[model samples]
Each structure stands twice: as structure tokens, then as C-alpha cells.
Target: MGSSYQLQQQAIDAEIRSLEGSIRALKLRRNTFAPISSLPNEVIAIIFSFLRARVTLFAIKPGKKPDGLAWLRVAHVCHQWREIALNQPHFWSHVDFTAVSSAGAAEILSRAKTVPLHLEVGAPVGLWDDARFGPFQKELQDRVPHICRLAISAEPFHLHRILKGLIMPAPTLEFLSLASENDHRGGAAFVPDSLFDGSTPRLSSLELWNCDISWMSPLLGSLKHLEIRSPFKWPSLSVWLDALDQMPQLKTLALHRASPVAPWGLIPSEVERAVTLPSLTHFEVSSPARYCGFALAHLILPALTSLCVVAESSRRDYSDVQEILTFVSRHAHGPQDSRPLQSVLVRSNGMGVEIVAWTSPDVHVELSEQISVSDARHSGRVSFSITNSDDWSPRVDTGTLSAVMEALPLDGLVTFTAQNRFNRQFWLWHAPKWPLLRHVRLTPAAERGFREMLMEDNKRRGGPLLPLLKTLVLVDVALLERRNLRLCDALTKRVEQGVPLETLDLRKCLATGHAIELLSKIVVDVLAPEKTYETGSDLVSEAGARLIYVEDEYSEVEDYDEDDADTGSDDEVQDMDGDTSSDIYGEGEAVYW
Candidate 1:
């Protein structure tokens, strides 16, 4: 009888717990349906806009249901939310019929009403069946007037076929980017002449890739940004100038692999007058050397802030560089002829040299030479190198550098770099010309010549070569010789005299531990080579003084390949493991090559 009573007591306890849970659930349900749930439709719509989904609508293929979307989530929240969402036409203005069924497309269009649309439409690659795009094309044709932005990427043939006889009613269109997709035949498509019927008055941005469009098209008058890539044939210089004259408001222009009507070797007997692009601020041209040369010579841009010139073939000509200097000389003048250029970056490879300026990197220039310039975001750097030939003279480089120095205002220059084969003696002689320079980076060969200048400055006892230099970075500088030691002593004396020599980075240097430690005692921060060597501070100097020992190790020689370096192009850079390149310079540090 006692055991039966215990089991009955446990059953009563279980029943009490179940009743408590039921009461808590009832309270939660009551809170969910409180009076605050009756929000105004306008308030609900504003909130929904904040939570609206941004997706590539064209990525949704036909017959596939899009699950877990923001609009769907809101509609399923409650009956009130469902009613509000279904009634708001703007909520469904962005339609992707490519992924949904015909019935779904119809409902979306009906709900969107007459609101402006941003359409991403095209028959995806490999869908040769015209039946697949019947419903999609019909909807696009009907909604042509409402599309403000159109981005289409499809085969040229298919694109032409879709809009052959259809008149585009795109009066409100502002931006249009059309590109050929997977055209293995090198994008030789003849664009229809009457495609837009001379419409698109409001089109300000136009980009055409691998499609031939007449330069005389009246529809191109209002374009502000223009890019033509892989044209079927090069237009004559006169024709190019005529087309440019029409687009007076063009701000940015880019031409890639665009041929010229004139053949390479024959110069036109009649020279076309240069076009004055008062509004153009950024320009880029990549073509054969002759074509690039002619274009640079004939274009006059008083407002050009950024420029990129890519010579596809290897042939050293100073006229192109001279033309660039002349163009800069014309624009780089204030009322009193103040130098407008703040910085000039010049880089060279085995083939040739590339010279650029630091107004902005709105323009990307690629050349056969491995010269490059980054935008304002990253530090602007230019690297120059030449073939290691004894007979190769620096005359060409001398003229180039002289032209650059004359064209730029060096009063604002803070950082400078003279790297491999950069006419070291020439730079050393001219080092004192710029007084405000603070940071300097030099390679092993360049540093050798720089040591002489430092010694000359030390002898003066007052003026220094770089008086304001605080941090020094030297690449592949080995302090194994007596002369190198004296140079270090001179630098140490400069630091002792309150020049603020805070950091000394001796990258890939060959030096004894005692030598490094002795140098470290003089300088605040010393980055010696990471090498395994004797660690002793008892090395007797030439003056018979013992110095602290520092253990140093040598790392593998870092090789620099021009082709492998980042040219700052739109193309993404990836490593063998699929990782991308990262920024090398940190905040507050100067960028030098």
C-alpha cells in the first residue's frame, strides 16, 4: 500500500508541470497578438524597404523556386503583412522572369504596375533553343520603356536577333552596359544600325565590348563614360576625333586592343588637328606602339588628371614620353605657372619605361615594360629596370628623368625611389636638388653611389643630403666592407646630432652579428637579416673598441619579376593556392619604389 501511494504522488507532480507549460505558452501567444501589431501600412512598407533583398535576378533560372527571400519572408510573417506586401507595386518592381514560371512572371508584372525597372536580361550561354527565351523576351519588350538600367551579357548573334526589328522605347535609360558572352570567334558581331532608332537621349554611361557600333550613331551624344573593347576594325583618327567632338561631356574614356585605320609604318600625309577635351579627366589607351603614339600626340586634354598608355610592342621611343610631358606642361600651370603635378612615378623593365603621374588612378595603363602606378588608396610606386648590358647607356633614361623633373613641382615631393639600373650616379648628383624629401629607398647598386654623397654631406658638418629623413629602408645592402662601416658611422653621427634617425631597415644584408649589434646600439630600430651566425659582442673594431654581438641569419634572395608584380589593373591577382594579393604599405608610411 505504501509503494502504490508513492507512484500516485509522482503522477500528480507530472500533471502539475504540464499545466504550468500550457499557461506560459498562452501568455506568449497573447503578447504576439498585442495592439502594437496593428502598424500602419506606410510604416510597414518603409520597414520592408530597409529589409529588401538585393540579388542578381537573372541568376534565378526558369522553373526553380526562390526560397527564403526577403519579400517572401515578410509575406509569410502574418496575414496583415501578406496583404500589405501584395498590394505594394514597388516591392515587386524588380522582376526576374528567367528563373520563375510564366504564371509567376505574370503575377510579378501585374503587381509591379508601371514603376521604373532595372532589368538584367539575356539568354544564358548554351541555351540555343529560342523556345527557352520566348516568354522572357516578350516581357522585356513590353517593359522596355520602364527600364532605367540595362545590363545584358549574351552572344552577339543572339543579342541582335532578340532586338532586330524592335524599337527600344528607352527614353528614361541612364546606364547601359552590353557585353558579348563566350564568343569564341573573337567577338566579330555586326551590331544592328537601327537597334535603338536614334533614341537613348538620357544615356550617360555606355560600355560596348566585342560589338561593332557605328561611331556616327546620334545616340552617343550624351555619353559621359565610354569604353570600347575589341572593336572589329579601327576607325580613322579623323573619325575618332569626330565622334569625340560629339560627346563634349565625356569624363572617362578607355580603349583596349583597338586598332587604328592607318597602317603601322605609313604616316598619314595630312595630320588631323588635335581634339581639345576640356571635360575629360581620365583616359586609357592600350594598342600597338604606333597607334598609341599617334593618339597621344593628337589628343589635348587641359583637364586630364590621370593617364595610362600601354605600348603592346617593344620599341623604345622618347617622343611618346615627350608628348606626355608637353601635355602635362600645358595643364600643370597655375596663374603663376605653378607645377600642377604633385608626384611623378616612372618604372622600367627589360623592354621600355612607363611614366605616370599621381592625380588619380582613374586610368589604368599597361605597357610592355613592367611600369605601373596605383590610385590614391594605395601608395603610388614606380619601378624602373633595364637589361644588364654594359653598352646600354642611360642617355634615354637621363632625358626621360630630366623631362619628368622639369615637368613636376618637387617642392611637395616627400618620398623617392631609385632602383635597379636607374643611373645611380646621376640621381646621387641631383639628390640635393629637392630640399623637402623625407624618405629614400635605394637598391644595392643605387646605395653604393649614395654612400659617396652621404660622406660628402658629413664633411660639410652642417647640411645633410636628406636632413629630415627619419626612417631608412635599404634593400640588399651588405655592410661587410670598411667603407660601409664608415658610412654607418656617418649615419650614426647624424642621428646623434638630433636628425631623428629612428629606424634602420637593412633588408637582405650580409653583416657580422657584432657589426649589426654595434649599429643597433646607435640606431633605435634595427631590422637585420635573419641568418644563423655567431652571436658575439666582442668584435674589435678598427679603432680597437669592442662592440655588442648580434646573431643574424640570411634568408633566400627575394627575386622580383616585372611580369609577376601587381600592375594595378582590373584583373584580379591570385596565388597558386587561390589567395589574392594584399596591401604592402601600412598607414603613416611613405610609398616608394
Candidate 2:
């Protein structure tokens, strides 16, 4: 009986082993018939490339752990995928040193097999002395010759160490980005003069933040896109011109706080002949007004389609502003002169002033948010921004606003959008400047001044202001009884003066039924709520209306009185309008009111 039991146990164990083998064989067979398995190797590699791009983008987000190799997990899905991933040399060529262990780096390098590499290395935060950093530095040193794109962000000391070992030639390199993080803690890191042995023949895009490179470096010769921020030293104006002269093919140039300090008595007349950048289409600069003016005065961008100048000074000087305006006037026309300035957005508040002009008629500009240079570039817009140096100040200097508005080329402007507050007298004086202006969009704070401008224009013996104006959009307004009557009176007067508005769009406005009815009779088309929503009954009281309006008005104004020049009291009944500031700008396309 014991022998029989042993035999049965042995048979059961053998059967179990047999079943496992059969299952393994079935899985292999199943994989063979899978739809993905039928794809060509090249197609599979393409699919992997897409996944790699997406994963790489997410991995680069601030404060996120470096996981450059995370895309390789697809290989672990199955044996077939593993084989495909392993066979593609290009798939292994991108090595982010931070994501790999020393041993893993060696394996990846071996698998890459002489393929040009794209390397990314970021020093670990607060752990620049980590033991693993040594291996990364060594790998970068050994792999410099094969690197095609290298982007590294490190603290100054670590960056110096890594760059010190990269003296070898990088024949295949095309893009290079070196940013020194936490640079404010100490002096900036300087790029070694011997970097790449000055032999990066194919480099086209170069970006450096808190890193300084020689203005005369040979690497500048081939760059098509150049960006430098917070450089350790600003080269002389002549040196900058010489460097730019070497980069004839440069398409995009961004200099943030990187301009040379203007000579004590520097003026536009003192600037030498401008260096012409024939190929440059996008130019952006952020610096003190004087520095920006000095830089622009030295360069001529004939092909420039997008220009963004952010002036960060509060010195009350208009000379720099004049220089910037002159630069804009020179390059205001669109490519090949096919498009001309058609829409203008002007935003002024206590913080500063922003002016955005688009050659395209259909461009919509948001009021409450700042517009970035890149955003303006892609949208074919030109923007000028002046931020108040003192945050506690109630408003930008009145002179600064006047200089910018007076210098604006508004002869052909057809659509005008003004937000926040402007000096009432200033608007009245400049209202007739836009001869071709047809559409006007205003925030509640801006509406009173504009309305008064229209009324003043009607009384003008010469002609009316914004004579071609046809559409009016009032945003975030409160149309109580008195305000309604005033607005209706203004529109009625405009009609009598032969400058009648065609459409009146009230967006996100608190309006009484009677107010909407009165506006409907004046405007050809009045866009407002049909139901009568009383301002003070259960929903909102007169005091409640004041609070609502004041709250929205003060949203952009910090520590400012409600009676400031830009805002009005609630009892006066400011005209009613609706929508967030963004909605007033339209979401997808320009909405002509």
C-alpha cells in the first residue's frame, strides 16, 4: 500500500510539471497570433517613439522625479515586445543619467551601439553630492562624442564638474541647454571656453540660464534659436552686435534680463548703425526700460512678425518707451505685407499697462491674465508690457500710459478692446485717434470713461470719435436704473450724431428688465438675459450690488480705494455687462459683438 501511494504521488507531481510546460507553450503560440505581433519592426519602433515623447514630457515637469527611462516599461509587457525594444538601437540612445543606476547606464550604452545619443542630466535637489552623481559625470565624459542633444540643469558646482569633462568634440550635437538652478545662492557658472573643443558643427539651438558663454564663441555661429536668461555678465553693445552678426540664420532670439547696462548718457542718437537680422521672425526682450531700448536701438529686425517687450522699470522716463514704440512701428507689418494691424487690445491698471496688437483681425486678447511671449509668437501677435516695479503702488505712472498710447499706430485699427481703468481725460483726448475703429469692448471700470468720450465726441464741431464704431461690448457691468439711463442717453446721442452702435453685448452683467428693454431699443442687437432679475430683491440688494461691483473692481487692484480714478461708486449704477474677463475676450474665436 505504501509503494502504491508513492507511485500516485509521483504521477501527480509529473502531471503538474507537464501542465506548466503546456501553458508556457500556449502563451508563446498566443503571442505569435496577436495583432501587434504582425506589425513590422519599424512600425513597432514608431509606436514606441510616440510613447517615449509623451513620457519624457511628463517626466520633465517641475518637482517630478526624473523617470526618463519610464517608457522602457513597454518592453516588460511581453517577450515579443522585449525583443522588439531591444533590437531597436535608437530606442536605447536617449539616456537620462539621473534615472539610471551605474550598471543600468552601462547596459543602456552598450545597447545603444554607436547610435547618436540624446542625454539629459539634472542634479538631484539638495543632494548634489550624492554618490550616484559621480558615475553620471563619468558617463557624460565618455559619451560626449556621440551626444546629439544634451540638456542639463544643475547647481553651479555640479554643472562646472560636468562641463569640465565635456571638452571633447561633439560632432553630432544639434541642441544644447545648460541651466544653473539656485544660481542666486552664489555667482553664476561660466561655460568653459574649451567646451566641445569649439567644434560643435551641427549645433542649431542653444539655451543657457544663469550660465555665461563668451560672446565670440564659435558655437554662436550656427544657432537658429538662441535664448539666454540671467547671464553672469552682460557683454558690451558692440560685443552683442558682433555676436548677432555671426548668427545670420537665427530665427528666434529671447533675452531675459540679459541686456547690457546702458551707458550713463546713452540715447537713441548715440546708438550706432543697427545690426540687421534678416532671418529673425520672433524677438523678445525683458529688462529695464532703458536696457531694452538700448538693445532694440542696436538691432533691426526686418523680418520680425512677433515682438514682445516687457519693461520692468518705474523710472518715469519715456525715452525707452519711445525707442520701443519706434521699433514696433518699423516692424508692424505682417509677413510680405499681406496683413496689417487690424485689432488692438489695451489693458491698463494699477499694476502696469499692456498693449497687444495683432495684424490679423480675428485675434482675441484676454484682459485679466498676462500674455506670454511664446503665446504671442504662435498667434502672430505683437505685445508690449510694462510692469510696475513697486507692487504697492496704486497705478502705473500716468506719463507711461500716455507715452505708450500716443505712440501706438492706430490709423488702421478696426477693433479695439480696453480693460481695467484709463484716465478719463486721456481717453477723451485720444478717442478720435482710431479713425477706422469699428468695434469697442470695455470692462466696467473702463465703460464710464468711454461713454463720456462718445458724448464729448458728439459735441465736437469737427466730427465724432470712433466714427466707424458699430459694436459695443460692456463686460462685468452693473446696470442699475441711473446707469441704464446714462448708457441709453449716450447711445441715443451717438445715433443722433450719425455714429450709432450696431451691436451691444452685455456679458455677465446684473441687469434689471427695464434696463435691457431700454438698451434693446438703442442697439440694433442687445444680448442680455430675458428674465427680469431685480438687483435688490432676495437675489441682490442695492448695497449687495455695490459690494458685488466693488469686489470685482478691486480684484485687480490691491490696497486701493473704491473711489480711485479707475472705479466708480455703486449708487451711480455703472452700466451692466456679463462674463469673466476671459469670456469677454472670447474662448476659441474672436466674437464680434
Candidate 3:
């Protein structure tokens, strides 16, 4: 009887617990919830006023389901939430005319008041069907000056409404980006030519992407930056180049070509036009160089400072680098009238055809070993990175380095990298001590540290070992295996005894489960896996440090496409694993290389 009574008591307890949970949930959902007025009105206004572009008609939300007057019910369910949402008029300013019924458009307008409004219409069918968009148009036209920004697709009616209509000049317009095209036979297909003849003066930034234009003239005299991306619709590079030539105040320019044009050489000629801009500082161009038949045989930009060439849908041609050098040498010649460029950058960008910045002359090298580039150009800052996997024969490399060492202003060359051949004889030699190495990069097979016999090898040539090295970049290394320790230990010992190495960049090198252990034994000050987080100290130097882990500085390949369900251009790029690249730079450390 005692055991049975205990069981009965437990059953009663369970029933009581279930009842309490239901009661709590009902309390949270019902009209019993607290009122928004309960909080200070200032707090409520601050919270709701900032939700402009995001909160549209509360009656229709993105990917959310509501059955039968749910919004009104929420207001009626509890008085507080309704009051907070209702009092916030600015929250209802943006009207997304996507799903809202035509009959209710006027009702939404009534709530919007005279405030500046943003209207986004996705379905183009509503353009001419005045029954649907007439009320919304009336609201937008009334507040044209307040419409600081507008994004509309190409359709005859949209063009007529926005362009042809007596559109008041939007003086406050700071940015205008259009991908104008038309499905209607008479839409603004030739609209840019007819409507945009240097008319919009206040527009400071323009991005033309696949925009068809008979005449590419733009009123961008005050424009500071311009981006033109793969205009498959464009006929000639002349229209674009002419537009740029007219813009006297342009500071930065980015050019990207997507398709194969009939006259491929036009773009190369157009790039040469940029040499005319005395104010042009930063220029990045991505195009097919091979099709650009002209070798930049003779040209120079006296004012050019930063240059980035990314080959897009095009392979890198050795001739491109040759052309640039020849042009710079010829046009920027003479010790008296040379414009010294502070930064130079070139990249093939993709894995296809390679860009050869360093070429083996027919004679293997020019024997002049004492080249003074500053006497020739005066601009001391030079940064060059070329990626190509070619057979740089030992003799050719020695000759090339001899030429490079002669040509380069070594002390001024702060950052440099040449990644292709690891077994080149130069790797086996050329200690940076002559220049007192600051930054050095060696490929996978090029092991760090010299063996005893190797020192004797350098001695035979009287080449000094680099002792004051501060930084080293070792990439594409297969150092995870135990056999690799032979090299790792050698590097560690050299750093501790010979070189006062402070920083190491090991980008894209693999790491095993016991990576820290292997590295700890071989390197000084190796941060333990448990202590892998970055310290708050700048120049985090520990005296007598043996070995430490410096994060690799290589690009991490992304294995994107999360759902396998949607890989469209619109879906945000996602990785199966969380973002693999999260290493941030140290706060105040000066990166010398």
C-alpha cells in the first residue's frame, strides 16, 4: 500500500507540471503581454524609428505566413505592441509594392504622409497597369526630392515614368547606378544616348554594367571613381575611353572586360589614354591582353602611383609585362624628367594562362650588374609579384637575379615575391645578407637553413649568409609529415642562433593534428594550440624564444554552395564549413614586408 501510494503521488505531480507549462505559454501569447507604452516613449521611438528600409507593409512580410488579419490581431491581442508599431510613422515609410493588393495601395499611401519614400517594384507588369501603380506613383512624384535613391529595372513604362516625365532635378542625389535595358520595343534601349548627354551633373559615382549605350558620354567631370564591368552589350571601347578622357577630375578607374570583342586591340590603346591624366593615381584594369595586339611599346604616366592589372577572362602574356617595362623605360627615361611611381602591382588573378614578369632574354642576362633605377626614374618604391610555374633553369635564374639585383633599388624594394620554381639554383644560393634581408620567400622544396656543407658551398663563392633577417614567407610547403622536421629544425636553429627572426608568414601550408607539437619541438616560441589566440601586445617578442606559430598568409580555397539547393548568382556565397579565413592582423605591428 505504501509503494502504490508513492506511484499515485508521482502521477499527480507530473499532471500539475504539464498544466503549469501550458499556462505560461498561453500567458506569453495572449493579450496579457506588457504594453509598449509601459516602456519610456523615448526608448520606443528610438527603437522603431531606425527600422526604415527593412520594415515594409507589416501586412506583407518576406517568407512569413499570416492567416486572416494576423497583424490587426497582434495589435488587438495586446494593446502595447499595436501602440508601439502604430506610433512609429517612419517605420512605414518604405513601401515595397511587391504583394500588396492594388485596392490597398492608396490606404498604404495615406499612412506614409509627406515623408520621403522608397518604392521598390519587382514585377514590371505593374508599370502600365495604372490601376495597380497609379496611387504609388502619385506618392513618389509628390516626394521626388526626398527620393534620395532609386533602383529600377529597364521597361518602357518605368523609363517613361522616371526619365521622360517632368522629373524634378534631384540635387541631393549622391549616387546613381543603373543597368538600364528595355523589353518594350521603344523603351530606353537607346535611352542613354537620347537622355544622358552629360545631363546629370550632381551624380558623382557611376557603375555601368552591361548597359547598352550608342554614345558612352557621361557628365562625370566631378566624378572621383568609375567602374565598368563586362558590358557584353557594348560595341566599342572608344565610347568608354572617350567618356573617361572627358572626366578631368577622375581619381580612380576600374576596367573589366567579359566577352570577346571583334576589335580586341582597342582596350590596350584605351589604357594608354589613361597615361594622359595628371591627376590619375589609382588605376586597375582587367582585360584580355593577347587580343590587345599593341605592345605598350612606348608610354609612361608621370603621375601614376598605384596600378593593378587583373586578367579577366583572359590569360597572362609575357608580352604584357614586357610592354609595360619598355613603355615605362622609354617614356619615363632620363634622370632629369622622370616620374617615380611609388607602387606597381600586376596579377593574372586566375589559374589559367600565366603572367611572366621576369623573362629570360636570348642572352640569358644583360651583364650590367650595377643598375641605379632611381637615377633613371627616382621613384624608389617597387612591389612586384608574379605567379607562373615555369622551368626557370639554374643558369637562367642566376642571370635573371643578377639582372634583377642590378636593376632593382634593393633598399627601396620593401615587398617582393617570386613563386614558381623551387629548385632553381638561386634558391640554393643568394643569401639576402648583401642587402641585409628584410623579407624573403622560398617555395615548397626550398628548405630553410644551410647544412654545414652548404655553408662551405656559399664560402666557395664568398657569398655571405643573411644574418639580420626579420621576416620570411614559406608557402605551398608539405611540412605536415615527420620527414619534414629535418628542414623545420634547421630553420629553428638558424633563427635562434644566427638570424634574429621576429615574424614568419606560412601561408597555405598544411598542418596535422600534432602540428603544434611538431612545430614546438623545432621552432622557438611556438604558441601552443591551447594558446593559439593572438596576444594583445605589439611586437610580441619573447627573449631567447626558440620557435612559434605565425599564421599562414595564403588564400584559403572556398568550397562554397551550402544547400546544393541554390547556387544561383543571387545566393550569398557560403562554405560547407564555417568561414575558414578569420585570422585578423595584429593591432599596431608594422608589417615591413
The TM-score leader among the candidates is 2
Q: List model 3 lDDT by residue over 393-504, tens digit each.
A: 1111222222233333333233334333222123333333134345554443232222211222234344435555455555544343432454455556664455545555
Give the TM-scores of the predictions, in the order they appear: 0.63, 0.81, 0.51
lDDT string for model 2 (140-187, tens) is 888888988888988888888788888899999998988887744686
Candidate 2 Cα errors over 4 Å, as ranges: 1-21, 31-37, 54-78, 99-109, 183-185, 314-324, 331-336, 348-351, 369-374, 377-380, 390-394, 457-463, 529-545, 551-593
Order of candidates by TM-score, top first? 2, 1, 3
Show model 1 residue runs off by greater than 4 Å.
Answer: 1-40, 50-88, 95-110, 122-124, 185-187, 259-272, 316-339, 343-356, 359-411, 417-423, 440-463, 473-490, 493-520, 523-593
Off by over 4 Å in 3: 1-144, 153-168, 180-201, 214-219, 232-242, 258-282, 290-306, 312-318, 325-350, 353-467, 471-485, 489-497, 500-522, 527-593
**By TM-score, how accurate is candidate 1?**
0.63
- TM-score of model number 3: 0.51
All predictions: root-mean-square deviation over Cα?
13.2, 7.7, 17.4
lDDT of 2 at 495: 90
Question: Between prediction 1 and prediction 3, which has the larger TM-score?
Answer: 1
